[model samples]
Target chain A: MANERMLMKGNEALAEAAVRAGCKCYFGYPITPQTEIAAYMSKRMPKCGGVFLQAESEIAAINMVYGAAATGVRAMTSSSSPGISLKSEGISYAAGCDLPCVVVNVQRGGPGLGGIQPAQSDYYLATKAGGHGDFYIPVYAPCSVQEMADYAVKAFDMADKFRTPVMILSDGLLGQMMEPVVFPEITDNEPEKDWACTGHGNKRRHNIINSLYLKPEELEESNRERFKKYEIEKAELPEVETYLTEDAEIVVTGYGASARIVRSAVNAARAEGIKAGMIRPITLWPFPEKAYAETVETAKAYLVVELSMGQMVDDVRLATSCKRPVRFFGRTGGVIHTPAEILAQIKLIAKEELK
Target chain B: MKRITVIAGHYGSGKSTFAANYAIDMAARGEAVTVVDMDTVNPYYRTADLGDIFEKNGVKLAAPRYAGTNLDVPILDFDIPGLYAEGRNLVIDLGGDDAGAYPLGKFRQFIGLHKNECDILYVVNFCRFLTHNAEEAEEILREIERACGLSATGIVNNSNLGFETDSEIIGSGRLKAEKISALTGLPIFCHTLPDIPSCEGIDREGYYPLTVYIKNVWN
Candidate 1:
């Protein structure tokens, strides 16, 4: 079916996609570069017979998502860096209770409330451990505004399919850039939430949603069960986009905005007759280990470019099993690296290592 | 007699893109153009980002104090009144909708002083919601006029779906713009279309071929 394309900002497109993906409830607090998501939802949700709540805090927003998702409703909450930090506790709680919800972290520069520019500094916070527990949420890193819209639907589906919290890990660049997007046709194939804590009406046993299991053995059982699901996810998910990686000497790797810049740099290097390739992780959590390993046979070295201080570089090293030398190039505190800067790094790598 | 154009519209309605293009065009035509970024609501994708292009084209850019500084401070720091007194052709890029237009009241006195010389242009994109129809468009324009204490003298039909814009989209946008023009008794200032081959069948009256300066990464 031909869908009418429209020019939309990244945040607006993501919000509209979530609504079309059967997201009935949206809870968010306004933050820079991502407030358009809440603004779009406020105008859209009510008109579509849904709920849009501007919660008092990020904590309240994610907890509202948790509560709403417990009723078998597709619920979502979005925030930037510091706000996402505030939401970590609630996210962990939802994960502990095995609830399916979508959390969008349109990240900004951060260790604290850093700056309001695009940054992928939260790779660890998102892919490694969002909160204190040993839980992993499937993280999607979209490089384009169209991908931003596409992943919103996929994030919700993955959350429901796995019965676990899922995250769309975007940065300020993807959250703010305007581009043309056509939404996917939504099929109403919602998974049956038989474990939802809706009132049983005496026809079935009342289901209770709780994260606190006082018994250590029960907690261990829950943790072990979640890890088993992670293993299945690692096999079924882990999407990666490879560009000209066959018989290339240098493989540049990054995700989100960095990947977009790296793609351009790879093209520039190719134009100069350098065997430069790229591997972009669409799914950041499973880390696309197999894709990286596949390129290891042909790749001489790896260049990991990011907007942070070498967070994803470690993953690339581990994915390749440290066979190839993985070097990182990055800029922090809200500064974006240009394609020329990345191209310079690639040229240097070719001159030093490729020789 | 300086021509002061203030571009106001709904959010994501191509205000910054139009303002940048207009300023660049005026400067290229040997007008002393000064483009002021009065957008305080949105932090990204403002006219200020085109400062380099403006500089190269001999257009003065009056960006906010906090722009490109990595500071998360929302401060209105443009000297619109001072820029107005320079007698240069002034093109002000406002924020989106009523909330974004509220900051325009800071230079309400300059707009009031040069009421005859000032041309407040309401950029309309039928592709956007809330202002998708004539009635809704008029409602938003009224809200913007109230918020800025300045009435729009002309309407710019800048309806586009980014890269997917075609003649059909342009025709639909024109129909909506005509309705808005009829409802508000405002003249159609111009229709903004990209310099694409598909725009051949569209009406050429008051047609301004737009050079899309604001772009995403992949474009």
Candidate 2:
């Protein structure tokens, strides 16, 4: 019955998936659009023999995850945009210390607690820059509630695989929307954590979990080793979902919730006899440059859509290396882009290509 | 039918979606209906989110204070006593369980005065957490009743798993709802079905087929 199709909100599905994925510890604070994750964890975690802590604040919550993750336990924390900002320091420490943990940012609008509605403004923060450090977190953008559930499990696996913090970049719309989702089968395939800070009891060499490396040469070595791991991560990850791009003139692209709207618009354009296609990046950090490369010759121009003022647009341009013109259209402050509006942009691009 | 209908349920029980559709259905029947949203606990996907839909359908939506804005603070904006005194058809969409339904206690005196005219309906979804069984459903119903100081007159079997709902889900949920009905001695008002094509074989008796208004754009 657990695998049977059931309707669930994105937040609840993510929490349930985390539990099934062998996540032993969860720490979170209450915030709109993402409070359901904490609420679900409160009820389900204790029943499943997992620890759920509602820390005093967002800063406290992420530090709690850091402590739990150091002991080789699967620990995670979730929050909204403002709360994610508060957790940035802890995330940087996890990246520096090579502590594997999951961080979910079910983003709401923001510059300063902008709105309770959904927005995709945190692309740059999650991918290119997080806290003050030379680090990159694996960022996944899930488009539907089902993917929200699937990616929560994948995030934990990927985090442990690379021994780094993995970020699931969701938005308010995906957080609150309801859809039917089938949960994945539970597996106990976790790798042994010989580097964990578990008590040795005079049996073996004690493990040290730390982020401070004062020696300049030693820190450079640490940074270089981490960059080598990131190179593999970039090569192994970076998933993209493409639609009708073989002979297309204009390709529309977006990530997470905005990509759902872009897919609909691309379909509408195809129906109207325009050679429009879509390329949705499922991984934000890697940017899926290979997918863009495959379309560079066939697709004449690119249209990037988003819920913010075009944060992911910069990635599209860089991925294409300015070989094609990339246009950006977006709605900010929680206003979502309608499919009709995106279709109109595609129409304009199609007509201009005639010249 | 009662003049005032109050819908209460556990979290994610589809109460807001049902209340929104019920208000529109009443408006279609030429009733001057004003649906009041008192869900301050959970911010998103409440009746407040469908303000434009309600406006287009000729239904009045009275959302909470500071709703539809960036502020996360909870405030009851409507004058409940005035709405009760206005003599229009009223549908109050309460928040989940006792926490979200606590605001309804302020209008208890008005509702008690017109007890016969008020129909406090408890919506049930078997798939939701904390209410998967008859005993669990009764406990939540009693909690909501205690929080609002009113007894539920009816039980609405609104059991569906979003867009994946089908006739089999409806049947299984009805069986569970019937057990609760037997234990609590409340009548089953109606079984709600999502307006999907897979429900062709579903029985139409006492069924309320609804066009799901709150949906993802791609769906």
Candidate 3:
């Protein structure tokens, strides 16, 4: 089927993909930057004969997702920053039960009820396990509208493949931007229904899906097994795109919308005498470490720029392992740094590195 | 000091009626009391609304203006205008149970931040959910505390059989109160009646569920 072309907003693509990927249930609150996802689902999902519940709150929305996902059907919920914060407990529980589900965090400014603008401020909260335990979710950071449309299928697959909570770590820009996208043709991926909580029936006994493990040894075994799966994920799931890295002396790196901006910055920098390349990590949690393995060889120093105050810098620093100094340029609270501003930083980095 | 008391319980447990009486009593005592109608589940129980007597007394009623409008957003918005610091009470009349209590989660972190002035009273009906048994009551209490981020919760046995509530049922409620007190270690602050001034209250009011009556002709 010659890929159908359509002008699509990022949020609309996500909702459409969720349907095409066999996601039948959706629970969400209407929030800015991501309302189109819910609105699109509300109209299309009902027509598709799926369940669309505009929950009492984000907590209720996530809990409803938890309930539906526990039954092992494709269930999802979407929200922005503060709303994502409220869903932390349910997300952690999903992780604990090893349930395959997707959480779309269309991030805005945060720490509190922040502004409804694009921001990658949730880099830490999304990557580092929050909410009260040692559980991790494979976080995917998509840069373009194509990935936004694409990952609704990919996230559920990755989540099922790992039996982990998979995140499409997007910001307001990716959530709102309209672009050309080729939606995946609806076909059966045929997910395994063995572990799902869709009623045990007479198959054997009750299949209890819970996070609580009362015995210490029992909990210890689970924690160990979860990490083992994470290790396998760490080895396999690294993604990035490198532009002009052949003889580049300085690397400009970011993810989500910041990567799109930094890509523009790199194009501008190459026009100048500075050989700057942009490395965009599409998968954030099982971070694209392989791309950064030879950081000292290709680039003298890596500049990690983002909308939040040096959030992704921590990951880049660990990936580089201090072999080369990783400089950070960031602004907090929903402020977007222009390509011109980032190019200026690249110029400064070229001056210091080439010297 | 003015107290910001949060009255919370499960669905159909008379939380709003109890809250209304408490606010009215405080108002009648010549004290400035603000009653926020934070019941998101049922809008009809809201006593202090747009033009109600409670609103007439600057009661500051904050209930969801309509249904299905952002359920997670607290039904009643909170506005503490130097009235409370001046020794006036701020009583937030909350909705029932975990589903009802969810909108309050956003305020929970703030409650932890304050931790001093705000007090949450888990309004228990010896009638609803796990409150009928000691173990069930303890589990419900634990669930409420965990969900609400509340370390301390006082109880109010609003265990009346609606308009027909009587003394014997109240006695059974007292038995529940004793068991709950032992289980959760929280004291029963008060019990409620259905404004029954003289006649014995009914035993089967609970059997009468609140049903919506739609006006119609034969179709």
Per-candidate local distance difference test = 0.89, 0.89, 0.73
lDDT of 3 by residue, A1-355 (tens): 2373444557877888888888889999988768767877886787888999999999999889888887888888999888888999989888888888888999987778777677888988898954669988888887776788787888888877888778888987777654556787666774777877676668777788888889999999999998999899988887778777777788889888887788888888888978888788888878888788766687898999888988888788888887887999987786778888888999998888778
Give model 1's DockQ, 2 decimals.
0.51
DockQ of each: 0.51, 0.61, 0.01
Model 2 clash number: 0
State in Å the error of residue A93, model 1: 0.4
The model with the greatest TM-score is 2
A1-355 in candidate 2: lDDT tens per residue? 7667767889988999999999999999999879989988988899999999999999999999999999999999999999999999999999999999999999988889688889999988899878988999999999998999999999999999999999999999899887788898867767999999899999999999998988989999999999999999999998889989998889999999998888889889999999999999999987799999899999889999998888988788889888999999999888898999999999999888635
Better of 2 and 3 by lDDT: 2
Model 2 residue runs over 4 Å out of place are B27-32, B52-60, B108-114, B129-136, B200-203
* lDDT of model 1 at position A47: 91
Q: Which lDDT tens digits does candidate 3 get at residues B1-219?
A: 236777777544566666766776677678787776665543332444333656655555554455322223434444434334556677776665565566667577656666687767766665442255567656666665666666645777766543334576567776877777777788766655554532234453533222111111000
Which ten residues in a row are the worst by lDDT in model 3 chain A? A1-10
What is candidate 1's lDDT per residue for A272-351, written digit by digit as tens? Answer: 99999999999999889998999998899999999999999889989999999999999998888888999999999999
**What TM-score would every model get versus the actual structure?**
0.93, 0.95, 0.62
Candidate with top DockQ is 2
RMSD of each: 2.6, 2.1, 20.4
